[model samples]
Target: MPHDDVTTPSVTTEQNNQEVLDVFGKHRDLASLPVTENDMPIGLINRAIFMSQMSKPYHRELYNRKSCIAFMDKEPLVVDAAMSIEALTFKAVEYGEKALADGFIIARDGRFLGIGHGLQLMRVVADMQAEKNRQIMHSIDYASTIQRSMLRPSREALARTLDDAGLVWEPRDVVGGDFYHFAAFEDGWFAALADCTGHGVPGAFLTLISSSILTQAIEQRGPRDPGALLMAVNRGIKQMLGQLDGNDETPGSNDGMDAAFFWFDNASRRLAFAGAKSALFVLQPGDEEGEIVDGERMGVGYVDTDLDFTWQNRFVQTQPGSVVFVTTDGLIDQIGGPKEIAFGKRRIRETIRGSRHASAARINEAVLDQYRAWQGHHRRRDDLTFFCFRVQ
Candidate 1:
């Protein structure tokens, strides 16, 4: 450690206590002094302890003839000059609480180099940590850009499948685990909204895996059945995460997603839907109540879930003005409000049902406005996603 305020205050064991006290007087900022024999360090002497004892009446006279070895610490923290700051910090704690305040001797090949100050060591460590954080944040921001480009190009394609639509995708963090999928195969199109487990980087990783796997499954299975598509995705997630039954490599790999998927068939003018612990809301023209078609209770690809567990499909016949809505738990399960209750499926149904006469954009706006107001000062619990469309 180098400091402009301090120079090496090294003394010899042959020197008397009075001479060591004179060294402290020369360097008022010095916290501790190294006591050495030849060029090798033997012990450390704290200035505070030595000064307090010497300040007593007749003590300086009594100790003037005594060797400095009498006041020097027999065992002090000694560190290699080339040692990393991180390793040295652990060594300092192990040496005892006094090691930081008293400082350590920086030695090269068992010979004293200089005194290492605790304050300077801490400053270097702090600067290193700050730089590391800045690099991580920069990488995540670039990742956010890539994720957006990957997700957003298919709005025009979806517009052809549905009459009118509005979508909301808000991650609690800047980047999150929630994502929506769109693909076209043969005559019609497919759309899905997925909420993977966890949040931030871990969750963002799943969105990539789930979205890519879902696309591959569509190509192989022909995009006619929503349930089969979901099954393939479930298996794909398990295979990707190494969560298959016989695999013991990743014992802690309990990860998956809750999703609502749709296959819009232009031939039959019908929409087939499947969900993994998800639900869809439908509000038809002139209907007093909107319908909530709940999907299977199980989620996709968790370690505990059965591989053979089948996801069932619900068919909703499309009409010219019928509206469909789907939401992830982040929206319905947000913890806020005066009572801190979940916004709930009941509120969603009420919002959509009340706005049955309005356009998809207007209804979506109303829902978001209500949701934000309800969220108030509470931190978001998870990534929020919601999507809705009017039939052609």
Candidate 2:
């Protein structure tokens, strides 16, 4: 009778190999080998190597007659548990074709506790990378949530300033450079759409900077005059970048925002809107006719624009049920659906017009649905955002 070891699982090494094969079977980069107490590996076996060996008479004889110990290679590569992935991979690669075997064994006090397989070791490293990304994402989410709270309420929140009101926001990455906020200032609700210079990390930083300035300006002054708020924000951002003194040629690059803002007065049923670089779309009541305010673009410090960068204020007096759409560049920039085409502004206009009667939430959903359909097999390259509301 043979004495059984309690520490070891009852399953045989071959069974363990089979189980490993079943799970990581598709990983061509992996391989397994038998180990010996002498610190030498007997026969080197990979999926390819084993298949070839099985077909040969000489190799079978070699395998059957010799104690796996007889074929042991004197010097086996081993590593500690704390070895960096770079070192582990380098060591694995050092074995050349034999590197596919179980990864470096983790030993403590001169005893083997466990083994790290190639795929699993790589996964461990990947998990660390994923965790870091999650932390970054959480930070961004927090910042955006805080900024959103500072936004003014929608015009519909008061009287019937707009027939309907809603906001649409989608981030390309975990965080986006485009953002929108709503606030009830003097008489009506004030809203804004901001597109910073970049997206993701760089753009997110600029947006925070711009958002803070905007909030402070609003709190200190008021949203009565949209142009004044923007100008103050522009100057604040310039000052932060030390470019407010007119020395455009500096060591670092310029940081600025392209934005549009509107103030809807519920009392007098008047609407005041101003834009830096963003455009506006309005759907008139009881008519299929649409209006596109080709209003001039606005620029902050360090950014250049030729299309009437001056801030122009526009007004519209209306009854209930008028829909207005404002958006950042993200939604229109989505790449590829059928033939990998951009979801251009034209497509957006049609979608909005078609869903004009839908609720704010439904309209938002419809726009995203159109975008997704257009981006069939393609992925979202940038953040997708839009604001839809009807004057009540």
lDDT of each: 0.86, 0.65
Q: What is the lDDT of residue 280 in candidate 2?
A: 82
Kindly list the per-residue Cα lDDT of model 1 for residues 1-392, writing each as its tens digit. 43334457799889999889888888898899999998899999999999898889999889988999877888999988888888998898788877878888888899888898778777877898999989999998888887787787655566555567888888888789999977766678788999999999889988988888988998899777889988999999999899999998888889999999988887876889999999889888777897888889989999877887799999988777889899899989987889999988888888888888788888899898888898898988999888888877
User: Considering every candidate listed, which one attains the maximal TM-score?
Assistant: 1
lDDT of 2 by residue, 109-228 (tens): 444444456666556667877998899879878866654553434323433343456666666765677767677645678888888878777777777788888889888888877777
Badly placed stretches (over 4 Å) of model 2 are 1-127, 130-163, 242-252, 301-309, 317-319, 357-361
User: Which window of 10 residues has the lowest lDDT sum in candidate 2?
Assistant: 1-10
Clash count in backbone of candidate 2: 19
lDDT score, residue 232, model 2? 76
* TM-score of every prediction relative to native: 0.91, 0.64
